[model samples]
Structures are given as structure tokens and as C-alpha cells.
Target: MKSRKGVRAAVTLAAAALGALAFDGTASAAPLPPGGGSWDHVWKGSSGDFTIYVKEYGDVVSICDTKADGKTPTVWVGPGNGHTTQYWFTAPGGKGACNTKSSSDGAKYRLKRGQKYTVTGCAWGCNTWDFRDRH
Candidate 1:
């Protein structure tokens, strides 16, 4: 009877240890931005494809992109650990007439007469890029 009790206590301790390990990583869960809106769009780069998701932290907009299959997207902020692509403001990059202001970089991602912003994640990489307001 004494041995049986010891075995049961050991098993319970092991189970508790495992549970603690599982919950250890939960603290880093991605912080959800206001309005529950994500600005992630699938993009197909020359090397591969990825998805860009935008969100807000405090007063800044963040952008994060992950590879569609294998390759990781090079974000201006950091690794695409599911939440490393957050941005605050956007300055005009590429050349185009923008209809909507990008919340990620605060720049207008629009279309230009002789310029083009390589937009990814649209019908296999062949779509005219334009910034559309989120509804």
C-alpha cells in the first residue's frame, strides 16, 4: 500500500510538470489589435510567396508576413514569428496613385502611370496593386 501511494504521487507530479511546460509558452501569445482587424494579404515574391498581416499595438500599426509554403518573408521589422510585422506609419514607397492610406506604414499604396508596386497574393501574382479602404 505504501509503494502504491508513492507511485500515484509521482505520476501526479509528472503530469503537473508537463502541464506547466505547456502553459509556459502561452504568455507570448500575439496581442490582438483594436477592432479585431488584420491587414494580412497573401503576396507572391520572386523567390516565393507569403502573407502580410497588419495590426495595431499602441498607436502604431504593425506588419507581419509569413511564407506561404516554406521560405520566410523578410519583414522590415523582424522575423515573421506570427507577430513581428507590426508598423506604426507608412511613408510613400513605390510609385502609384493611392486611394487608401496604408495603416501599416501610413503610406498610400496606389497605382502609378509608369511605376508599379509589386503586390503579392492576388490570383497567382498578376494583379494591379491598389490600396483599398477596410470596411
Candidate 2:
């Protein structure tokens, strides 16, 4: 029932809309990163007076002590998978402290991924301090 010009105009408009999409900046989904991104399991454990956790992301390692049930947690990180370098952080300003780490200058201790480490200096979450599992 519509005029041929109207039909032709409608078709032209649709084609133009599709053409605009073809030139859009977006393309196919991004490709995966090299090495396909490797990740190791995090380790966490708690003693009679505390709880601790250790995790590794890429080249970075994080240790946390979530003072739970009035217990201080001990966290640990081990140089595994040929990974010898990592970092550290203390939680809640200071409830659990890292007693052992890579060197004598830092809170020191050894902990493997999926394993838990005991904490000292910051125990029982008494002072609301969380120690960075330095090792």
C-alpha cells in the first residue's frame, strides 16, 4: 500500500544504519593474556588465638590476618612455581604481626599457598592489629 519511494527510502535508511555499525570502534572480544594468566591457591589458617591468610596474584603476594573470634591469624607465602619475589602488607594498622618473612628486617615466617602460618607480636587480636605475613 505504500509508495515505492517510501519503501526505497526505508531500505536505504536500514542500510545506512548497518554501515555505521560496521565502522564502530568496537571489534571482536579481547584476546587472552600471555601465559594465560597463572594463579595459585591462597592459604589461610588460624591458631588457638588468631586466624591468617595468604594469597598470590600474578607477581604480587598478599598476606592478611582477620582477627576472628578474638584470635590472631598467621599468614604465610612461599616462593613456589619458581616465584621467589613477593610483597607484604599489615592489616588494621597493626592485631596480628608478621613475625617471619624473606629477611630479618621484616616480620618473618614461611607459609605455602593453601597453608597457614602462625603469628607473633600481634596475637589474640588484642590491639586490633593484623600482621602482614612477611615471608
Candidate 3:
């Protein structure tokens, strides 16, 4: 049987050790899986037409565009992940317009490390009237 004094001493040492290792405290949004397998693959469109693969918390690994008419837009301009891209598009009924180009596509594009990429544009501006899938 261990004495009470011995148990108290052991717990005090453990607390000191834990305090040393927990400095500069930071937390994660999701628990990392075993062997570092906490990859998050989310489909974040309203219609579920695109897939964004994020690994290691916020690293975007790959983006898969499933829709035939859907164009995978890049956050950067000038010869991006696709051949066709628009700087900005007007909303339906031409009420508002947003400009995203940097004077003929020379803007520096850098992905943020701990932030989410959001493409805010007119939701109904790029809709096609007729979409026929032949698969």
C-alpha cells in the first residue's frame, strides 16, 4: 500500500511536467485521427457539385469539379487551374457588379494558412438554362 504522502508527491510532479509541455496553447477544430489521418473532404456548394479536399487542418489538397458545366475557379488569376475564368460577374437583373482582377490579371495570389477560401459572387449569375447530362 502506497502512503498518502507518496501519492501527493507523484501527482505534483505530473502537474509540473504537463504545465511545461502545454505552453503556447493552441486548439484544433477537429480531432486528428490516428497516424495523422484527420483529412477533411467536404463538398461545400449549395448543390454539391464540387469537392474540396482539406488535409492537415486547412491544407487544400485537391478540388474536384463534378458538374459538366461547373467551372472550377481559382482564387488566383492568370492561367489558373482552368483555362476559362471570369474576373467578375454581375448579379441577375444587373443590379450589382464586383471586380476581382488586378489591372489585367497581375494580382498576387496567396492561400491563407489558417483561413477558409470563400468565393463571394452572384449565385444566380452563372446558371445555365439547359443542362443535359449524357452519362
| lDDT (Cα atoms) of all candidates against the true structure | 0.22, 0.26, 0.23
**Clashes (N, CA, C under 3 Å) per candidate:** 20, 22, 0
TM-score, predicted candidate 1 vs. hidden true structure:
0.22
- lDDT of candidate 2? 0.26
Count residue pairs with overlapping backbones in model 2.
22
Per-residue alpha-carbon lDDT of candidate 3 for residues 25-99, written as tens digits (9 for 90 to 100): 233122111232333322223443332223322222223333334344222111222233323322111111111
Clashing pairs in 3: none
- Which stretches of candidate 1 lie above 4 Å from their native place? 1-25, 31-35, 38-51, 54-62, 65-108, 112-117, 120-135
**What is the C-alpha lDDT profile of model 2 across 45-69, one tens digit per residue?**
3233322222232123233333334
Best by lDDT: 2
RMSD (CA, Å), each prediction: 21.5, 25.7, 24.1
Positional deviation of residue 91's Cα in model 2 after best superposition, in angstroms? 1.9
* Local error of candidate 2 at residue 112 (angstroms): 16
- Number of clashes in model 1? 20
Q: What is the lDDT of residue 73 in candidate 3?
A: 25
Score every model by TM-score.
0.22, 0.24, 0.27
